[model samples]
Target: TNIKKKMKPIKQTCFDKAILRHRSVIETVFDELKNLCQIEHTRHRSSANFVVNLLGGLVAYCLMPSKPKIPVAGTYL
Candidate 1:
């Protein structure tokens, strides 16, 4: 099958687990944003309301002191 053929090689290596581990942080951030900011709900009755809600949630997230962060190492690339 196509799926088996495509996944066969990837499953043979550890790279897939590494990639998933890297993405887990991003996934957790999105999960937090959705739950804490209530952005996942589509209850807006109007286009303007939807846009405002979306922007407001994002701005609030950015202004929060507990926002998720990735630590930086030595120097900038």
Candidate 2:
């Protein structure tokens, strides 16, 4: 079957592991913007209001302090 041909039991590379670890941060940012900021619900009567809100959100994101990245435990030799 074509599905069987595509199924290879290859080992996951380091890059794959890195992405799996870091992807959650990006998803959280999107969730926050949509839920907390009401960015998706913005409906302005004028162009100025639209621009101001969009720019304001972007500025807030840049100024926001990031959560500290916890250090991964090291294996002993």
Candidate 3:
């Protein structure tokens, strides 16, 4: 694909791996927020309740002990 060809140069660098790993972590967090945190629920009776529910999910996510983190690879040393 054209996009792949354009990205070929960057893919040759070691930083590309780190960047991809970081992006994967972000994607995983969004997925978990949408599914596990019930952030996509639309049955709320009022807009105020909806905002409260959304904030609660984000707060709960922030307080979680186990969360996504980038690995500390030896290459960074």
Every model: Cα RMSD to truth? 5.7, 7.0, 5.2
In angstroms, the error of model 2 at 64 is 0.7
Per-residue lDDT tens digits of candidate 1, residues 1-77? 12364465533346665545557666778887798877877777899999999898898788877765544374432
Candidate 3 regions exceeding 4 Å error are 1-21, 41-43, 71-77
C-alpha RMSD in Å of predicted model 1 compared with the true structure? 5.7
Model 2: CA > 4 A from native: 1-23, 35-38, 67-77
Kindly indicate the candidate among 1 and 3 with the higher TM-score.
1
> TM-score winner among the candidates?
1
Model 3 Cα lDDT, one tens digit per residue, 1-77: 12364464443466665566578777999998998777886898999999999999999888887887766764421
Model 3 CA lDDT for position 46? 95
**Candidate 2: lDDT of 6?**
61
Model 1: ten consecutive residues of lowest lDDT:
1-10
Better by lDDT, candidate 3 or 2 = 3
Q: Judging by lDDT against the true structure, name the best candidate.
A: 3
Better of 1 and 2 by TM-score: 1
What TM-score, computed on C-alpha atoms, does each candidate reach?
A: 0.60, 0.47, 0.57
